[model samples]
Target chain A: MTERLNEDQPIFIQIAELIETSIVEGDRLANEQVPSTNEFAKHYQINPATAAKGINLLVDQGILFKKRGVGMFVTEDAKQIILAKRQERFYTHYVQPLLQEAKRISLTQEQLLDFIKEGFSHED
Target chain B: MKISATDLNKIYKKEQALNHLSLTLEGNKIIGLLGKNGAGKTTLMRLIAGHFQPTSGQLEINGQSPFNHYSITRDVCLIQENYNFYEKFTIDDILKISAVFYPNWNASEAEELVTLFKLKRKRKISALSKGMLSAVGIIVGLASHSPITIFDEPYIGLDASYRSTFYDLLLQSYQEDPRLIILSTHLIDEVSKLFEEVAILHDGKLLLHEKAEDLAENHCIVSGPVKEVDKAIEGKQVLHQSTLLGQKTAILYDQEIDGNYDSLTFSKASIQELFVYLTKEEVVKHGDRN
Candidate 1:
């Protein structure tokens, strides 16, 4: 986790995405208390404010909620919310680019579909 | 604590160390003060720490001048790379003395750090290795708990592992007690992520002062065929450009990168890359005249 952050985007956004990934993978269940901002800062060697900003972004989006002074907790529907969000962006983030690259290589739609099916079989 | 410098200028003899610099920093933040050699990062920090009076302009900490002002100076600790201590004093003696000067200093924390850094209490300051001396400075800076702590290349001779430990300790202490921290180091890549704000100086002048996140977001590198790259960077501020055969790569600043240019590839320029390109551009411009 400490080595995952990169300069490709804002660190805060990456931090947020890491938490979201955990929630989506069910490693963090609903109402589970997340690590405090200070813990994240120390573990990641990042500024506490940057860690707070990332956590606050999740809170603002209803993916996490604060419990006064206790700490932040994963929302009950965090996985659903994250899945919906990613689904909405799937076309632009994944499908559109995949399609563009396929078109660039002159791969027909049928060939692309066949390739994707092969990819799924390999994954299993 | 809030520090505001308006049109600050510092001159040593005929050399201008800082020139017409204005900046404001407030609240709890870890700000990275970045610049090349002799770019006046130390001069600006010294002015803020009340070591030297600015040749001209106002430098105020919480609306009060820091020069010879004990009230402000007590709250600010400026630890330089080559810090000098009484050669006769032991490591414990130095820590005790610092605890007296910095009212907010935590003795227990200092002791823990001393042990962590593996410094002998009875060892005199004059007998320590360069890396050990840097560790002592790190201990003092972290345990001082000053509102405005400034570290100018605080770890000069420390090894890679020690440097990593220093960073971890710095973050841990800052998280325990939030304060305004200004860190100036040439090793920017190792610590760039720890900065909330970044203030870059080039030849005694303020180049840019902005949020670290925004700095990473606003700058990028675009690469492709020379003609495509040229067309993509038209009317944009290109900080640096290089060409190999027909392939061209240019670093763009504060430019909206259009993804519609399918032939071109875009990648975010890291802060260290941006700093190098930005300052190197000035040097190149200066060399052209000579």
Candidate 2:
């Protein structure tokens, strides 16, 4: 794998994050086999040991499971588990910041509700 | 599973291909054998495969010399880049030959990959494109299930999608069988992940054989304002540099850097750049013993 050698974070951590997001986004589905450690290495052009470390991190978090004679598969409850983990990061990571921005902008609840409705319309 | 190469030397006229090169590969892990053009990568592969004898040294696979031993040859499969096949023979005929040679040949696995690669068994090997021929070679290599398999630059003319498919299949096979695999390639950005240990060669000599993570950890690229980057990178071994806009980006060789700096981003060094620096005769790193 050709690793991205940016100093912002360790390459292994980036790999772990990518794999985690892959699972959460359904890029790698529940119960479906994911790439082998070496496959991750080749896909990203990284060392196999580093790839294995990233894979093992997901395994450690119960996001993925290994099948003997086969390969790694997304955990059965991957979606629910990640959703719960994401939920645990609510106020500290996202909500409080949005609220602070809203206060700074002097935004009211009605205006925010209107903004949410507009966002929903844009998606459609 | 130990292979010892001692004082191995090969010369073609004035150019020394392999210069007294000797190293031992531990068993059951992926290894990356890397070097510049004409650095004797193919020669090493052929030598270990017993295709040719070294001028001065010998290669031993599992304590037995692979030279002139059909038993060892049966278990060792070396896939040369740009493999050539007989124009008259179809892919099926080659599969049959493989079945006879390799004791652990998996027919079902071969068939699956043949279809996965969209290979036509009835087509003559001479009719396949460069990529298709590579696919045929890969099918045989994976299906052979050899104890020790070496791929010398497998993805030469392949398209991106085909290359990705090759990597997927290689990983799947390795996971299932868990044997020794060695790959040599120049497209470092595309296939660096397949390596467990990287053995870099310079002038037909082994430079370093360490983990892939270590290679990235050992080097970085620093880019920001020219003044700041230059000041911070002073006295460091700069592999390459360029000025884009008002910023300067310098490639640093092997430094311990914790990921924390204002207005500066740290990333891993490209293996290609490292190769160029390593092959150059004058570049120096104060603490780099290798």
The numbered model that scores best in DockQ is 1
- For residues B132-208, what per-residue lDDT tens digits would candidate 2 score against the true structure? 88888888888989989889887667898988788777776787787889888887656666667788877777778
Q: By lDDT, who's the top model here?
A: 1
- The clash tally of candidate 1 reads 0
Q: Which ten residues in a row have the lowest lDDT in candidate 2 chain B?
A: B255-264
Roughly what TM-score does model 2 have, to 2 decimal places? 0.71
Name every residue pair that clashes in candidate 1.
none
lDDT of 1 by residue, A21-110 (tens): 889988899999888898888888888888889999999999999999899999998989999998999987788778878987999999
For model 1, what is the C-alpha lDDT against the true structure?
0.90
Poorly placed runs, candidate 1 (over 4 Å): A1-3, A96-112, B245-247, B281-290
Rate residue B215 of model 1 by lDDT. 91
Interface DockQ per candidate: 0.77, 0.25
Q: How close is candidate 2 at the interface, in terms of C-alpha RMSD after superposing the true interface residues?
A: 3.9
